[model samples]
Target: MNFNIEPISTQIEEALQQKIDTKTKPLGSLGKLETIALKIGKIQDTLSPALNKPAILVCAADHGITQEGISPFPQEVTFQMVMNFLGGGAAINVFTQQNNIELVLADTGVNFDFEKHPSLLDYKIAKGTKNFASEAAMTIAQCEQAMQNGAAITEKLHANGTNIIGFGEMGIGNTTAAAALLTAYTNIDAKDAAGAGTGLDEKGIAHKAEVIAKAIAKQGIPNSPLEILATYGGFEIATICGAMLKAAELKMIVMVDGFIVTAAFLAASKINVTIADYALFCHKSNEKGHALMLDHLNAEPILDLGMRLGEGTGNAVAYPVIKSAVQFLNNMSSFADAGVATEK
Candidate 1:
C-alpha cells in the first residue's frame, strides 16, 4: 500500500456546525459525541459522515518470549483468545455485533495450527516470531511481508466501502514486547515502558524491565524505530503498523485501539509522520505504558474507562459515540428550517 502524505481539509467542519445547530437538543448538549461527529465529518469530508461497513481488523500472533513467563497468562491463552474471537464470545465480538461492524481475523504469527474458519485470513509470517532476547524477533523481510498483509486487508476494505477501520491484537507476552519497543523508540527507560501486562506480579514486572533492558543493550545498534520493531516487535505489531500506513494513504478515518496498537502507530509514524493526521485514538488503555505513549503521540482518546483488554474492546466501546455523532449530524435539521433562533 502507498504511504503518501494526506492533506488535511476543513470543508466538512462547516457542514458539521450546520447539522449540530439543527438537532432538537440544545447546541453542544451531547458533549463528546458532538465532537466525534464533527471529527468524522471533517475526516470524511461530508456533513453526513456514516460509518457504513465499519470493520475491526483483529491481528493475532504469539511472542516466543512467553516461554520466559513474563506474562501471567500462559502461551496457550493466545490460542484460547483466538478461539473466543472466532466463537463470538469476546468483548470485541459483542461490540461489533452491537454496532454492526464487520470483523476480520489475520493470523500474523500465531503458533497454533487451525483449520480454515470463515473469518480467518491466512497471512501467517511464521509459526511465531523469534524471542527478541535471543536474536532479532523478525527479519526485515518478515516485517515488510507482515505490512503487505495489512495493506492487502485495507485495500479490500476500501473497495468494499468501509469508511472507517479499527485495529486490535491478540498475542501473549505482547505488552512486554510493546513496552520494549516504546522504550527504544521514545527514549524512555525500560522500567517506564514495563507494565503489569496480564497482571504480572512485582517480581514479574521487575523481570520484564530487566529483560527488556538487556534486550536493548544487546541490540547495540542505533535506535531506529524500524530496526527496533524488526529486532523486538511482535508480528501483529508489524502488521498493524502497515495497516496504519495504508489507512493514511487511503485517506480513511483510522480508529486506533490501545497501547499495543499505539506502539505500532509509533513505529509507523517514524516511517511517515503524516499518518497521525488520519488517526483517531479510540481510548486509553489501562496498561501502565499507555498514557505515556498517548502523551508522546499527543493523542486525545475518545474514551477512558480504564480498559486494557487489547482485543479492540476500546474501539468497539467507542463506536456508538461515533455512530451518535454521525446520526446527529445527518438527522438534525438546520436552525433556519426548524424555526429555531440562529446566531443573529
Candidate 2:
C-alpha cells in the first residue's frame, strides 16, 4: 500500500516558537519539553495543539528464527505474553492503565491458535513467519497483507478520534530479526547490530551476532526496503511499520517505542522519509542496536531508564511526559497573563 506522508509543514514554526517563548519561563527552561511543544505545535499546525484519545498498538507474533536459539526465551513465551496482555497482567497493561492510555493488541502471527478474545484484533497472517536463516521470513504477498492489516487498524483508530498512537511488539527472536534489518538498512556490521534479547549472557550474545552474520550472508542484500522487511522482518514489525506510515499519512503523532518498534519505524522512514517528521522516539532501549538506530535516525528519545521490554512499555511510561508537553503548551501562563516579570 502507498502512503502519502508529507513532511510536516514549517509554516507555523515561527508562530509556535513565539508562543513557546512567550510562556512564563526562561527562554528555554523547559528543555526537551520545549522542543516537544514546538514539534507538536507544528504537527498540528496550531499553537494550541492537543493530543486526544491516545492509544498504543501492541502487536504480538512469533519468529521462526527461535530455532537458532538466538533468544534465551522459548517461542512459546510470545503466545504466553499475548495471553498475559489479554488478562491485563503485563507491564504494558499496567502502565497504560496508570497513564489512562488505551492499549490495543493484535495477533499478527503468533504460532498458537487463540480462542476468540474480544479485545484482541485477529489480524493473523499465518501461524508465524518462516525462519530467515534458511529462507525468506515471508512471501511478498504475506508481508504486504500484514502491512495492509496494520494500516487498516491505524485508520480505524484515526476514525475513532484517536490522533496519537504508539507502536509496540511481542515476538520471540524479534531482536534478531530487528538486528538483521538494521545491518541491511544501515549497512552496519552484524556484531554491532546484535544484542542480548530476553537476558542472554555474553556468550549467547556472541552466538546471536554470528547468526545475524550468517543470515545476512545467506540473504545477500535487500534490493528495497520492503525486501529487507520481507527478508528478515517479523509480522509484528511489518504490521507496525504499516501502522506508523499510515499514522504519518493521517498527520497523527507517532510514538515509537524501543529497538523493535524503532526498527519498524526505520523501515517505514526508509519507505517515506517524512514519517520521521511525525514521530517521537519514546525511549532509548538498552539494546546496542537501538542506540545505533537512534543515531542513524538522528532521533532523541524521551526517556532512557535502561528499558528493554518490547511490549510498548516504553511508550506507556514516557506518555505522561508527552501529555505534559501538550498540557503546558495549552494551559501554561504567559508572563503577561500571570502578571509576572520577564526574565531580565
Candidate 3:
C-alpha cells in the first residue's frame, strides 16, 4: 500500500532536450515521438534510454452490478473472455503477439473458478465484488488486499527486469462501476459518465445511468481514493490501481489502456499525484466519458483509433510506437556525427 512514488525529476530536462534537438533532423520533425524520447530519457535518468522486456498485465474480474443489467453481455462473458485470452483468440492476444509484447493475465476476482494455467496468475481476492447497488462493492480489507496483490505482481515484473508495463482489465458490467467512480471523483454527472457498455442500447444506457445515480445516492460521495475504490471499484480496477502505483514507484514506463484502465489511473493519481509522471496514455477510447477523463488528467493519447476494447489491446498496439521513440533517441545520430549542416 505504501508505494513511495517520487515525482519525475526535471533536472535532466535541459540535457535531454539538447540531445533530442541535436538529432540529425528538423528541430521538431519527430513531433510526439520526440516528446516520448525525452520522457523515457528522464525516466531512465540517462541521455540514452532503452526499453526492455515489455509486458502487459491483464486483470480479470466480475462486477456485482452486472445484476443490474447495465451491460448487454451476460456475466458469463467475463469468464469466457478469460478463456479466450488463454486460448489466444482474444484481440489482446493477437495484438500482443503481433507486437511481441509479453501478455500476463491475472484472475483478480472473476466469479468463476478457473483451472490453473501456466500463463494465468491466480490472485482472486474473492469470487467477485458484492453488489454495490445494495452496498459497498468490496469490503475495505478486500480492496486493500486486491491492491496489494496488484503491487506484488508489478514488483515481480520489475524485479525480473521488465521496465515497461501496461495494464488492462476484463470484467462484466465494470463500466457501471467505472462511471460511478468517475462521478464521485470528478463530480461529472451520472448521465455523462454512463455509456453504452458492451453494446447497450439508448434505453439500456438510460437505465444504466439511473442505476448508477441510485448507487451514488446510496453510497454518497467517498472521502478518498481508497474509499471510492472500496465503494464502487471492481476487483480488476483496484488491482490495476495498485499495479500502476508500483510501476511509478519503480520508475517504469506505465502504458495505460482505455476507459476502465483510465478509471484505475484516476484513482491511483488521486492517491499519489506523481503516478501520472511515469504514465503514457496509449489511446483515446470511443467509450463515453473517456475523452473527458483524458482531459481531466491533461493527457494526450498516442492514438485515436476509436478503440474501446480493453484487455490491454491499445497498449499492445501502441508498444511499437513507444519502442520507436526510444530507438530514435538511442540510435539516431547527432547533426555533427551525421555531417549535416545546420540551417542557415
Better of 1 and 2 by TM-score: 2
Where does candidate 3 clash, by residue pair? none
lDDT by residue for model 1 over 1-344, one digit each (tens)?
34786765686567667677567677788888777777777777776667778898999999987766788888888888898889989988998898888988888998999789988888999988888877888998998899988988998999999878999999999998899888888888888899998898888899999988888898754556677788889999999999878887888888999989989988888888888778888899989899999999998999999899988888888988777778777876666767877556
Off by over 4 Å in 1: 11-29, 221-223, 342-344
Candidate 2's TM-score reads: 0.99
Sort order, lDDT high to low = 2, 3, 1
Residue range 1-344, candidate 2, lDDT tens digits: 68998889799999889888999988999999999989998888998998889999999999989999998788899999999999999999999999999999999999999999899999999888999999999998999999999999999999999999998899999999999999999999999999988889999999999988998898888788998899999999999999999999999999999999999999998888999999999999999899999999999999999999889999999989999999998999998999998755
lDDT of all the models against the reference? 0.85, 0.93, 0.92
Residue 316 in candidate 3 has what lDDT? Answer: 94
| TM values, all candidates | 0.93, 0.99, 0.98
How displaced is residue 129 in candidate 1, in Å? 1.1
